[model samples]
Target chain A: MTTPLVSIDNLTVAFPIGRKLFGPPPMVKAVKNVSLSIPKGSFVGLVGESGSGKTTLGRAILQAAPITDGKITYDDGERRYDIASLSKDKLRDFRSQAQLIFQDPYAALSPRMTVRDIIAEPLEVMGLTKTREETDARVREIAAKCRINLEHLRRYPHAFSGGQRQRISIARTLAAGPKFVVADECVAALDVSIQADILNLLKQLQRDLDLTYLFISHDLSVVAHVCDYVAVMYLGEIVEEGPTREIFANPQHDYTKALLAAIPSLDPDQRSRVVSFERGTVTVDG
Target chain B: MSLLSVENLSIRFKTDEGLITTVENVSFDIQEGEVLGLVGESGSGKSVTAKAIMQLNGRNTVYDPASKITLHGGPDIDILSLKRERDMLPIRGGQISMIFQEPMASFAPAITVGKQMVEQLQIHTTMSKAQAKELSIEMLDRVGITEPARRFDQYVFEFSGGMRQRAMIAMALTTKPRLLIADEPTTALDVTIQRQVIDLMKELIGDFGMSILFITHDLGVIAQTADRVAVMYLGRIMEQGAVRDVLRTPAHAYTRGLLNALPNLDNLDAPLTPIPGDIPSPLERPSGCVFHTRNPELAPGSRYETEIPPMSEIRPGHFAALFPEDVQ
Candidate 1:
């Protein structure tokens, strides 16, 4: 088989809690011995409830979180880098190849910057373009692809609605021409109608730009709709991973089954069909 | 007669830009012991309608003179006529109680959970301090918070996210209000926790025999809890009907768009069709049908562009705001 765009082997991320100088500090294992591969140009969804370590696993792959143990490698089919021990220069170069789309669009973009500058900031910071004109051209191309109106490029974030602001955020993430993206709950803050629009945009961009996405979200229905492959995380470990259709049709894990059953059905007459499962919170292990 | 009836309700706010009409000519009734779901996206004024029921809108809010909100039982109080805070006391928490999306915000960080609940019971009823304490613990236990006596003495910060929400619900129900306004109570919770909360609420409603005004953007939650549903957009109700009729066979274009937009588990391969355009800002309110901007079925230069369609009864007790030909 061809080399995957991203590969992980027993990846683990841990955070120290209440450290002391005497002995080893207690460590909370945010991500535990997780292994998965994301193929090129594939939309892979990672879903779980809160405290399930889905976000940490996504960040670990992006080299944004502490890799306490295990291996994570990024291969663009051209160059492969060991994310845990990358040099400063290599890490800087890797930043342009992998990006993140934050959950809260309101907090992600700077309120002071106009839409043009916000999207262009990445190009400038990465020094991807030599001239200002080149940066403007790239920003315009991505903004247009994100379905943002050209006339609204001069307006601040406050002027746009939640849906429009999210589009702006997407344009900014794509400005540097990343091959892999981690969209962390990107549409959670938007309304359902707006969520569909954003999801459609992501799918279209994946095809147009040949991009791979590690979509991390708590909503299962969204994962089932957009993802080609699905991974279910529970308490810092991957309990199940398979094709989206197969996972949704026949879930194996108890946690995955409970989550699927918890989605309130739109059929009012099917109220009695709601499966009653034992409810318990998953606390992070230390 | 319904338990609570709101007729010709219009609310305008004095914003920095100009006079913004947030909720316009909206009308609905909640029968006793029935659940009414108010579904809308952001800026749809669903929360404003709930706040108006409690008279909790800010000082700059101006209610239309024709607006009437009458609570049917117990002397048939005219909610809109209440001017003083003292006059609203009996209705605010006595006959009407509200639970918010963020339980942390509703709860006082400094006060113990039990003390606050007991205080509400004392003010609303003639219960003594000792009696209120016992009832507070009982309510907490009823809502499924384990070790209620221990949890009562602790602050909200000490409780988990789910536990805090349960405490908030317990406190709200202690007054035995005839009507409860649950504003996105489960939005902050995980799916499993949300299911538990929904089940607890269903049990409470059955036991207390109180009406609930369930406000949320999630149609699924509405389907599970609400008997009647009202779809809102840009300060207007696009459709109002029985939940089954609205969800299964939505009549209005906006309502149909919302249902179609949701990613259905049953039809995983179907493409999601989002409503065409962004919900227009209040300052740029459309001249006619408020949803004309986002409605895909509306043709250009149609009467919908110039005239607001009245709510027409498409079926018995199912209403859609549409022109005769616009009905699907």
Candidate 2:
């Protein structure tokens, strides 16, 4: 088998609580010892409820969050770099190979920037393109792949709808030509009808570009449909990890079962059978 | 008897663009101890209709004078006719209680959760501070809050998101209002918490004997909780019927599109067929069916472009707005 693109070994992220004015301050363990691996050209889903630290895990992989312990190494079938201890030059190079698609399209994209500039900003900031023409060409190219209308690129973000804004956000993220993409709740804010469109677009892009995706969302139905492999998170730990179908059909963990049972099935004659599960609140580091 | 009845209710907001219609000729009834699910997309006017019943619209809102929004309490007393705050006061928090989408913002930061509940009970009823506090703690525990007394003294930020939502529900139920308007109460919560909250609401409905107008964008939630479901589109009721019938055999094109778009866990590879076009701005609603602009099955005719379509009964108690040729 080919080598894994990314491997995280016993990772932990802790945040200091209150202030260090008095004695040694306590720390909130946002994410505990967790180990996971992402294969090349695979769609992996990380799901959990609030305080699950799924978002923190995603950010840590992208080097956006503080990695308190353990090692995170990324390899693209070439040179490997320690994400936690990246040099300035290595970090700069890592930018072109890894990208993030933010959850809230409304807040993610700059309101003042036009759609063209928003998509082109990453290229210009990274100095990936030589001239304005090159940046414009690259923006148009990715926008087309994302199925965005070229005419709308001239308009500001305010002029577009939620779905359109998300497409614009996707296009901007992909403009960096990253091998791995972390889409954090990318379709959560969109309407159901529009969510399907975005989901399809993401899959098509993944297939066409040979890109790996870390799709993080709270919605299980969406995850079941799109993800190849699934990892269920609870209180910042992976409670279950398996094939999406296997996990959905028979969830092992109580938290995973509760999440599945909570989803109102679309079928009509289906009586919602409330699965008997403990609703015990897990207060970590309290 | 039905607790509330809305007949030919139309609402328009005076926007900078024009008189943007939000609700058009929408009508529904909520019987006592019944849960009605109002399911629709972003522009579906479900929230507007709920707000209209509570007289929560702003100064820019224009409700048709001929419209009938009757809030039936026992038998008589039309809530719409009561203009004075003194008269409407008894109905606002006394008869109808509302819970919003965001619980964090709805609560005050500085005040303790217990203090807020006590203040609401005092204003609406003749309960003393001591009596109110006791009942409030009971309400919190009933909603599955652990250490209710300790939680009562904590600020809103001190409670987790799920706990805060439970507190909101507990506060809403303190008055034991006859009608509960839960507008996307669980939409912001995680799936696990959402299930707990949905179950709690259903259980509360049984004991409280209160009518609920549950508004949400997810049709799946409607199928599970609501006895009946109404599918709204661009501020109009495209389809209204039993949850099973509506989900099994959706009459309107918009309803069909919505069902097709939802990601089905059972069928992993099914392509989500999104509705063709954007939801037309309320200011420029289509001449006939409001959904006709985005509908793929728009019959080729000048009539559809000019004349308005009337809602026709497709099944027993099921009404859908569609042209004859488009009916499946």
- Summarize candidate 2's per-residue lDDT along A149-222 as a digit string, tens digits: 99999999988778888999999999989999999999998988889889989999998888999999998899
Question: What's the CA error at residue A206 for candidate 2, in Å?
Answer: 0.8
lDDT of 2 by residue, B1-328 (tens): 7888898888899988878888888888988888899998888889989987788888798988867878786656666676677887878888899999999999999999999999999999999999999999999999999999999899999988888899999999999999999999989888767877888998999889899999999888888789888898888888898888889998987899999988887788787788876666565678877776777766677465677777778878888886565556
Give the C-alpha lDDT of model 2.
Answer: 0.87
lDDT of 1 by residue, B1-328 (tens): 4999999999999989989999999999999999999999999999999999999999999999999999997699999999999999989988999999999999999999988998888889999999999999999999999999999899999998889889998999999999999999999999988888998999999999999999999999999999999999989999999999999889998888999999999999899888877877789999989887777777799888889999999999999999887565
| Per-residue lDDT over A207-237 for candidate 1, one digit per residue giving the tens place of the 0 to 100 score | 8998999999999999999999999998889
Identify the runs in model 2 with alpha carbons over 4 angstroms from their true place: A22-24, A276-286, B299-303, B324-328
DockQ of 1: 0.84
Candidate 2 matches the true fold with a TM-score of 0.96
Off by over 4 Å in 1: A272-286, B325-328
For model 2, give the RMSD to the true fold: 2.0
Compute the lDDT of residue A163 as modeled in candidate 2: 86
> Model 1 residue A280 lDDT?
49
After best superposition, candidate 1 residue B107: deviation in angstroms?
A: 0.7
